[model samples]
Target: MDNISARENRQARLKRMLAPTSAVFIGGASMIPAVDNCRARGFQGPIYVVNPRRSELAGIPCVPNIASLPEVPEVAFIAVPRENVVGVVGELSAIGVAGAICNSAGFSEMRGGEQAQRDLVAAAGEMPVIGPNCPGVANFADRSVFMMDFFGEHDQNGSVALISNGGSYLSDLGSSDRSLPVAYSVGLGNQAMITAADVLDVVLDDERIRAVNIYFESIRNSAALSAAALKAARKGIPVIAIKGGRTTAGQRATQSHTASLAGDDTVASALFKRLGFVQVSTHTEALETLKMLVHAPKVKGRRTAYATSSGTYAVLGSDIAEANGLDLQPPSAEAAAEIEKHLPPFVHAANPLDIVSSADDGKKTLDIYRAFLSGNLDVAVNVMCYPPEGGWDPTTWDTNTTMFAQAARERGLPAAFVNTMPEMISRSVRERMIAEGLVPLQGLEDGLRAVSNAIRSSELAEIVARKSDEEILLPLYSANVTNPIALDEASAKAELANVGISVPRSVVVKPDQATSFEDLTFPVVVKALSADLSHKSELGAVALSLGTSDEAWRAVCSMAENLKKTAPEIAVSDFLVEEMVKDGVGELLVGIRRVDGIGLALTIGIGGTQAELLRDTATILLPASRDTIAEALRSLKLYQMLDGWRGRRKGDVEAAVDTIQKFSQFAISNGERFVEAEINPVIVRPQGKGVVAVDAVMRLAR
Candidate 1:
């Protein structure tokens, strides 16, 4: 059957699933809420007790078995012995249960039987399973259906819903109303089957769910989750996810806890940012960020404006904004004129609107605030921190001094209140700030990161989707690919050259005919053209810049001999004697590597060892556009060098980007036939000018 049919069948099965007599079932010996948290918070959903020996629990009748239930259970919590899990699931599936909280242990995570656990989890036929070993699920706004409690007697704030893999950390993350109102809180123990992707689809499409906070551990299904997250992102629903396990030990712990396959944390970080998700590290920070997104409106663009009561807070705010890719627009001439008349001489007009030394000056703050209320700024940050030390504490600042925030809320501009005195702030004051549409963050960095990430989550999705439009029709070279000798660099370049790319002048040299320097030219490059010597440079199969005729002949003979050392028995072929290409404006490194879940990722970086050491690299998805290629280059850490650092001439940035963009098109065009290739030094020239490939390699996919 097709996807729609499969999905329709799953829905039908879900509808027939039984409803639990106890809406919230506790399978473990977890501590229950002593206070009337459920009734106080308007949770009228029935609470069910499923202990076999007990008759009643939490003032409700208890059922001995699944068949003894008053009605079919819509959801059930499983925490029986490991050996009995399969039998319990078998019965639950047979009875047509819709969803479940699998708290039982020993499926795959702690041990090594991944396949067995996967099969068992699939018994319910794609039914959503939270964990085989987990802390269970909670619907906070649906009336305290959780064994654990974050707050007492807290009403539905209608702000953000949170999902985490690690329950220990989230339980400690201050879930007070002082942050944002949390709609739901769920912890997936092992993430047995139904993943973050499926759950996110519900939140993204739900009108009541404003923003989502995902505390991720191991990502088993990245592509599915990414697609689901983008759905939420497109609807302006900010998703802040923290992929735990940055170190070896951390990764191991993560694997044990959630059976997650943790690879490189940097890769995970990069993936989160690229896929329009805000990546965080700690629970304290993720909580604050979620609150900010819930409190702040959707950002229109990157530009930001600042209006603050203190001078030092402005600097801290600007530093944070710039570091996180948020543009703090400089005050316009008109805004500057107004600043000049009322502001302190020391505080010059700039990106940060520092109404200098506002010791007793509320007007300076108000004037700057009102000016920015209609200025070129898309967002604003009004800092309430001490001099030189940025903290988040409302009690430290004058509580009455909230006019800057007032104007921002009135204008519907996304804004954050930056406070440095986190410890000094009272819970009541913090709640007041959140109620007034201001997110209370620990310091400058966290505050700006929260805002920038939320904006990037929405904007990056649109940006990446644009990449799907420009498709390609060419391929790259690789060594592992089949029939390498039949299609060498010269041949591959010749092929790509047909699809709009430039290749340098070259000629193939047979073993019988060796060319002297005087005959071939003063400077020439000798490249072994045999599949037997794939990694040419590694096997001394490549020689560049021959000064004399004798040296050129010797180099070729040596390369021919080394072919045996490179690939023992493979047949050898003629080499290439090409004129050495001259120095150009820039050396662009372009290569192709398959990215898991994202398909092919065309890489463009600074050539030579810096590409590895400095890691001054950027990536573009396959069939990327000229605009995306150019933007990707600009996004690198060492991109300033391409823009002419200090006084040096700017490398041919445009030409280099164009070449890579074309190569990406080529990679996609060739599809399965082409495996991979890399052009280390592509010479680039002036504006909109063409580029030349100095060296290239390709391997046809076997």
Candidate 2:
């Protein structure tokens, strides 16, 4: 099928699954909760229960079988035994059902369920299936709830969608007391036929969704996910995600620095950033971030204004704000003058303004807030903690919060009601804040971090907006290597030099060849030339800084002797003699490698022997522009030294960037022909001189 047609078909199936007109439950009593949940969510359509043994389920008469149903269901929830899931799905598919949620477990996740999973997929055919081991979906917007598990009462009017690979996590997030505005919740389960990308593509089409939060253990389809994320960016919807299982357990074992540094998690991080998704570390941050995005307008900048009645909160807020990259500048001179009029004589006007207890009056608090927000800030935050009911009268707290919200609204600024502790804010106050058009952020640290993430989302949106579809989409290639070839240093350098990257003048000669050194420069370096010698220095196969022809020849002989003792099984027949790079400013490691699920990734970082020890690297997914390459370079800490540190001469940064860009283009053009390529310690000379690839390695798969 064509791309558009396939997408349309997938989307159509998803629409039916998420908002089915008529549904059938294919099981006995275990499917009762799904039926009841669907009905409780106000599903007015007919719901059929299919079980040959039971005549009734959850007050509904059972139809006995799929053949006995009154009408063809738009969707089905199959909770039969694992062995019968395939047959049921095939029957539904034959009947032209839109989709099915295979609630049956023991597929793909179990030790001996691989073939069953494959059989399930084959049975599904073109019909979309959510999971064989997943909790079904819950769509609050259309009031279609087909979930197997009970996730507390939720309002139909919500703006965020939660999707997860783990069923329990989805249930927990849906039932959490954080009061997140949830529009849809889906547990992906095994993702038999339907993937997270497929779900996201359909979810993004919902106009009611303002933000999406996902918890994924792995990304099954990167290209589709990238396209969906680009659509989200264009539509100005933020995607917050928490990726599980971040270990490098099954990464390819290669001798290249790229493989060591650019692990699966690192590449995934780069992919998320490139796709303009906000990746959070914990569920709290994800929930808090979703609240920020759903409740307020996007923060335009980092300039923030913090206001609190307690001095301690003011100090804590200031510290948290700074730590999270929020720019909490002091109030302007005119605004300070205006704020001082409301504060007592002892209080000073500043950012994180402490309006002491003396200014307890509602009118004075509102005046102070108005004055504080007048300082040209992008966001306004108020730190307020309400005591438990009956412990203290909340009349003053309510009045102050109302005034604070009013002041921020009058100024046309996004505002947040931040509490020091998560439990300090009651449900009533949180709902009130939401009604007042303000975000009620629970924890101080998580709230500030969420604010930072929200602001970063805005920035990333702008960046993604400037990129074309071609640039935004990653070129994911299949990894089918039958014949693999690892190129020696000379051949690798030739490949790099062919692409306009600078390489030193070099000559490859046999160890037994009688060669004249007059053609080469006086000061030269010698190294054993063999594809098997990945770490030449560690293998005692490298010799450097020879000042003359005899010295170079002697170094080559010594290298042969050392290699014989180090690796006697290998025969080093040839050696590489090259001129030493002089007056170099620094070294850099530029590498490109294809990750299994992800596409080709370009990693640039501090090079030389300590590259892994420093670990100061930044990655960019390929099909990236030169501007993106430069940005990645600039993010590295070594960029400071390359750009001239402590009055030192600047390295040829432009040359380095150009080299990396060309290298990336070469990888893209070659596609699956090559698996990995790296240039360690690409000596970057002083500004205007150029960069030279001194040491290199490359592996090709045919």
Candidate 3:
């Protein structure tokens, strides 16, 4: 089937499973909770149970088997033994059931379970299946709960869809006290038939869903996910994600420095960034960020105003704001004067304005807040820590928060009510703040981080929306390669030069024939050339700065002798004589390689001998625009030197950008033939001198 038809079919099946009008349970007493939970959540649709041995379960009559069902149900929850899962799913599909949640275990997660998982997928052809080893999904919007584990009671008016690969984390999030507004929670275990992308696409169609949160160890379908994420970006919805298993142990062993620098995690981060997904490190940050996006007004930039009653909190807020890249500029002179009228004499008027004296009077507090928020600000934050509910009168806290919320709402700025500690704010206070159109964020650190993420996400969403589909979307490519061949440095440089990249003028001659350097300039670089030698400098196969022909010849003889003593088994038959780049201002590593799950990713960073030691780099998925390449260069730490640090001359940044662009295009054009390509120490000369690729390495599939 074509992509359009396949997507439509998947969507239709997911709609039924998520918002089922009728559901059937197929198992023994173990399926009682699912049936009862569905009924308890006010599922007004018909419910059926299929068990051969039992006559009834949870006060509901049980049918003998699939053949005895009254009619085809919209969805089913199967909890039979692992071996019978395929048979039951096949029976359901034959009768045209929309979808099913395969709750059976021992599929793909155990020894010899791979075949069972494959058979299960084949049997459920065209039917959307949630999992073979997962707890099912919960739709608070429609009150349809088909999960095997106990899910907590949630407010039916949630706007975030929580999808996770770990079933335990999904269950914990569903039952936790974080009070995240959730429209749907899904545990995508194994993803045999339905992938996370499939779920995202289906759920995003629900207009009630404002944002999405995903937690996964690996992406099952990257192209589909990219499409779905792009859809979300176009719709102005944020997709927050946390990628687990961020390790480099699985990186492909290659000859280029790019492989070691751009590991799986780094590539995944770049993919997420290009797709405009807000990536967070922890579950708390994810939850808090979702809350901010869902409840608070949209943050346009980082100009923020922090209000607190405690002077210490005000100071701390300034520190945190600076650390998180928030601009906490002081109010205008007139605004400061207006704020000073309401504050005590000792409480100075600043960005994190202390309004302790005015906290008692609602009108005074509102006056101060209105004046403070009227300045050039994108967001307003108030810090408050409420004492125990019964121990103290709640009148003062209520007045301050209410007036602050009102003032922020009047200015139409995103507002956050942060507590220094996570547990200091009572649930009632949080709900009250929410009712007043304010986000009650827990923990000062996490709250600010959430605000930063929200603002950045909004900015990224705009960028994604403005970009053409071809610029943002990665085309599908096969990452498989067989017996890759490594090209020697000279041949690699020649290949790059064919693609518009500048290379030093050079001639490759046999080591025995290195009798003269008449074709090259005086000061030259000589290197032992062989495809098998990746690190020539380490093997004493490279010589630099030869001022005369005799010097060049002597350097070549010394390299031959040194290599013969160091690496006797390898033969070095040729040497490349090249002119040295003297006016170069900086050196950079430009590399492009195929990331298995993701597409070709271009990594730009500090180059030369310290490339890996410095470890300063930025990666972007392929098909990147020149603007994107320039931005990546600016993000590097060495960009300071390239941009004329101190009194030094500026490097040819435009030429560097062009070189990166050409190399990226070459990689894309030859992606099928090459596995990895790298140009280390691309000597960027002074402005107008252009750039040169001095060293290069390439691995091609045989």
Q: Encode model 1's per-residue lDDT on 1-702: one tens digit a residue.
A: 797686556444322222122343534334234123444555454556566766665566667776666665667667667766666677666776676777667877776757657766767665656677766555555554443444323345555767777677556552443455666666777777656665676656547788788877776665566666556655767778787755542232210111121224544665565566777766666766776767767776888776666567766667767888887767778877766666677767666765546525565555656665667777877766543325443332543236666767777877777666555455665666766776666666766777777777667656655433222211222322344223566776776677777876667766678543444556878887754344456667789888776777787787778776766676667777777655555666677643333345566676642444555666544555577678777887777766777865666676676677677778777766665566766776543455788767665555
lDDT of each: 0.62, 0.86, 0.87
> Model 1 has how many clashing residue pairs?
24
Name the candidate that leads on lDDT: 3
Best by TM-score: 2
lDDT (C-alpha) at residue 182 in model 2: 86
lDDT string for model 3 (1-702, tens) is 997898798899899899988999999888888888888877879999999998999889999999999999999999999978999999999999999998889998789999999999899988878888878889988899888887667767989899988777777666766557888999888888888888998888999999999997877667888888888888888999899987772355577889789888898899999999999998888888988999987899999999998888888877987898889999999999988888888876788888888899999999999999989899999987777656778788889999999999999888988887777577777888898988988888888899889998888888888888877777877756778898999989989999999999988877577355677876999999988887888998888988988888888878888888999888888888899998999999998888766778899999998899999999998888889999999999879999989989999999999999999989989868867889999999999889999999998787
Model 3: how far is 471 from its true place, Å?
Answer: 1.8
Give the TM-score comparing model 3 with the true structure, all chains together. Answer: 0.94
Which model is ahead, 1 or 3, in terms of TM-score?
3
Model with the higher TM-score, candidate 2 or 3:
2
| TM-scores, one per candidate | 0.75, 0.95, 0.94
Q: Could you arrange the candidates by TM-score from highest to lowest?
A: 2, 3, 1
* Model 1 spans > 4 angstroms off: 8-64, 144-154, 172-177, 246-275, 279-285, 301-318, 325-377, 385-399, 407-415, 435-437, 454-524, 527-541, 547-553, 559-585, 633-676, 683-702
The count of residue-pair clashes in candidate 2 stands at 0
